[model samples]
Target: MEDAMQFAPSENPALATYSPEVRQQLFRFVLQLADTSLILGHRLSEWCGHGPILEQDLAMANIALDLLGETRSLYQYAAELEGQGRTEDDLAYLRSATEYRNPLLVEQPNGDFADTVVRQFLFDNFHYHFLKQLVNNADERLAAIAEKSLKEATYHLKWSSEWVIRLGDGTEESHRRVEKSIAELWRFSGELTIPTALEKELQTIGLIPEYADIQASMTAHAERVMEEASLVIPQQVFMLTGGKDGRHTEHLGYILTELQYMQRTYPGMTW
Candidate 1:
């Protein structure tokens, strides 16, 4: 049982007294969480009209709705912290494709049921550990959010994990399909655990946990889940990075083009 909220500034006097750089770094990390949820929610929304079954179609939409709401709250708080007066809408829609910091795995197209499951499986596994780390943040507001969201993410991970088992241990075609999806997505996970300099500063100040510690826990969790599911981990050692640095895959560019079309077409458009 790791102390989730110990590092949150609102909960810890020492962390509340950290240097300005440390505080900003912690805020940036929070933005990454918000951005990730927003991007994934959007990706999931594509399933609303396209699911294989009516029940699955509605369920995916509900999940997307949940993610979008969570991301909205997270980014709204981030905007407030920045003091730039930017709204969550601004952060999500006004930014260009390159400005979005979501990992490539999330933005990648949902090829099939297998691809979607593998993508979500990877994301949920990573998020489970990320939320655990954030729960111990020195920033109380963020720590509290993490604590609440961790419960939701836990359910998401469980659902995806079960799907992995169902698909991986199914017929030979099912196994091969999921294995291929896993292999394709495996290379994109490197950026999830690699902390930037800003994150390092926050870690040193106790505003957030160290990336190395979270990575180790996340790796073990993923390995155990896959092992139980009778799946082999992809052996690819090469990994893609730079998404955190604002360099994104081309798929993101197209996604942004579609998502931002109405806003860009009518600059002051509002509900």
Candidate 2:
């Protein structure tokens, strides 16, 4: 809901030249990125004072802040492209669960500390590589955003990966917990690489990278990290879908309830 345009102008000359269809596709792609980070940040924020240790509590909170910051920037840009006078707040706080475009992986419940870490590890791995490729996107504004976000994504990946290794290589109980987390979350991860129709269009226009390449890189990195952590990568299975199309898991409704309560209760409220 924050105004991220303060950091950078929303205007992009290149975007102005796009045809209506391509412009809409770009808006959808940007919204997907924003929604993913916004939802994940909200999830991580729930662990603020609930982390297993004070250090971890603060770490997760900081990471959540980073994700939210990125979300604000993406939302700001997306709103500008829509050119309907919608602010970041309107796009974020007023949207229904079905209107959201975040993948299911980020919306799943953060079961326990280990579950949170495993989820973060998986998403961070994909995010890091995805942003890496996005940095070279033909859209200059998007590439700039990606260039800035990749730094934070790198740290997020490192932090989550370390926790995954620590827990997996720690006590037997810890290992069991993270292993379970992996199995439960792996099904949701496949959707990360399966580009939406909008994303495919962007890829064709060079506005986005090829999802197949991104998936391959993400898989290799994830497998290597799992091996180092002494954890087994679950076999590929049926991947969950529909989040990108605005269909979401039931968990998203609960998340939106809490997240939208303040805004709905006090319309136009700002810190």
Candidate 3:
């Protein structure tokens, strides 16, 4: 695993024993997780009032809250690790689009019902497997957080998976729309498994899951679900990058404008 706190109070040694360099890397990795959740949560929240149905509308909103809950835990930990006075809100709202570490997929626009479903299905698949590995992290704090988040990820994946199958194999119009959504979103899917340079370093130190292992788990589940959905799988799609490196699509700017509106405008506005 990449970024494992292997030097536990028992296993190897305490994390404090690690070089300053490794601690810095761990901070970066945690930010990636936090930023990804924050952006995706905001994206899903957009469907809150626009959902095709009342029940599913609330379902999407609930899932958005789930992602935000995970984001809070991750950002709080990241802030502690960074030893900065920055709060979770600072990390979530104060960062610019160029500073965010979420993958490009999460920041993309939700075009329609099928578009939302495919985007979510792809992300939920990867998130479920990723959290499963994190649940075993030697850092009990992270592992506990991962365990709690896993329950949400489990339901998230199931819900998105069912939607994929429902729309993919349904009426002619529904099937066509879902297939189009899959095609549009498939290219960004590659980035979920492709690690950045920082991740490779973390993998070597056992601080995070191996990209190969995560990719294998992700692929197996995705193939099974897509097969059941009867959706055509895209092959040899050109992959896009840069989100993990803090480069993002323009869509993120618009998302941030709305997402940060209150905090950015009021500066330190609190509950």
Candidate 4:
């Protein structure tokens, strides 16, 4: 048997099975998850004190903290898997925009309260469903992380789902705003659910579930929430992708500019 659990040697101990190619794919897969969380967390952190209301301001901050916490665990695991002598901070702070594999949805600017809410809703639904299955996947290491993160993702989905309904059914203005936000963000929603080359390989090797594994459940939740919200998902529209392939939109550069500034400037500064 291919040493399923002993992914790496004692020095790293991330993944011990599969060929070098599979290991490489899994490394990228883990980084994709970590990068997605880190970027989304950063975007939410941007709204820290700028939310439309005090209660919502605190809520957004709390969600951002939760995502950042997940990001830390993922990056630490990625660092170990890479066996590259890199730390979590190094991986988080040192990467260029094109080097990141996060879907474009998270890197998008928080346009308005409605924009943030819609983005969180779409992703939170998918995150909850995906993590639920991920806990039983091939890799116990990543599954352990997924198990803990799923707890937080549960709250995240509830919060976002409630906000989706609240905003969509609240007032004419709120409903209109969220509708507009959905149009802008919906194109990016398919990227994560659609498999990438690496993601497909991981599925083929039984290392992870195919991205489609969560789509049905995720879509069902979205339909239910959207129905409750009096909103309709737009069909027949073109969806934008490519973030997982390291091709990204213009926004990622600006994000990295601010994100990498401290580390690039000081080279080794710590708070």
Candidate 3 Cα outliers beyond 4 Å, as residue runs: 1-15
List where candidate 2 sits over 4 angstroms from the true fold: 1-11
Ranking by lDDT: 2, 3, 4, 1
In terms of lDDT, which candidate is strongest? 2
User: Quick one: ranking by TM-score, best first?
Assistant: 2, 4, 3, 1
Name the better of 1 and 2 by lDDT: 2
The alpha-carbon deviation from the true structure for residue 65 of candidate 3, after best TM-score superposition, in angstroms, is 0.6
- In candidate 2, what residue range of length 10 has the lowest lDDT sum? 1-10
lDDT winner between 1 and 4, please give it. Answer: 4
Instruction: List the RMSD of every prediction in angstroms.
Output: 4.5, 1.6, 4.3, 4.5
Quote the lDDT for 174 in model 3.
Answer: 94
Clashing pairs in 3: 1-208, 2-207, 2-208, 2-209, 3-207, 3-208, 4-207
Determine the backbone clash count of candidate 3. 7
The backbone clash count of each candidate, in order, is 10, 0, 7, 5
Which digits, one per residue and each the tens of the lDDT, describe model 4 over residues 50-84?
Answer: 98889989998888888887887777778777878
TM-scores for every candidate against the unseen true structure: 0.89, 0.96, 0.93, 0.94
Candidate 3: minimum summed lDDT over ten consecutive residues — where? 1-10
- For candidate 3, lDDT tens digit of each residue in 20-100? 888778878899999998889999999988999999999999899898888888887777667668876798889988889
Off by over 4 Å in 4: 1-14
lDDT of 2 at 78: 89
Best-fitting candidate, measured by TM-score? Answer: 2
For model 1 the local lDDT of residue 185 reads 89
Tens digits of lDDT, candidate 1, 1-271: 1211222224435444646665566557768777788888888998888998998787677767767767866776677566577876788779887777777778888889899888988888888888888887757777777887788788888878888998888889988999999888888887777777666776776777777887777888888878977898877568888777788888888888888888899986997
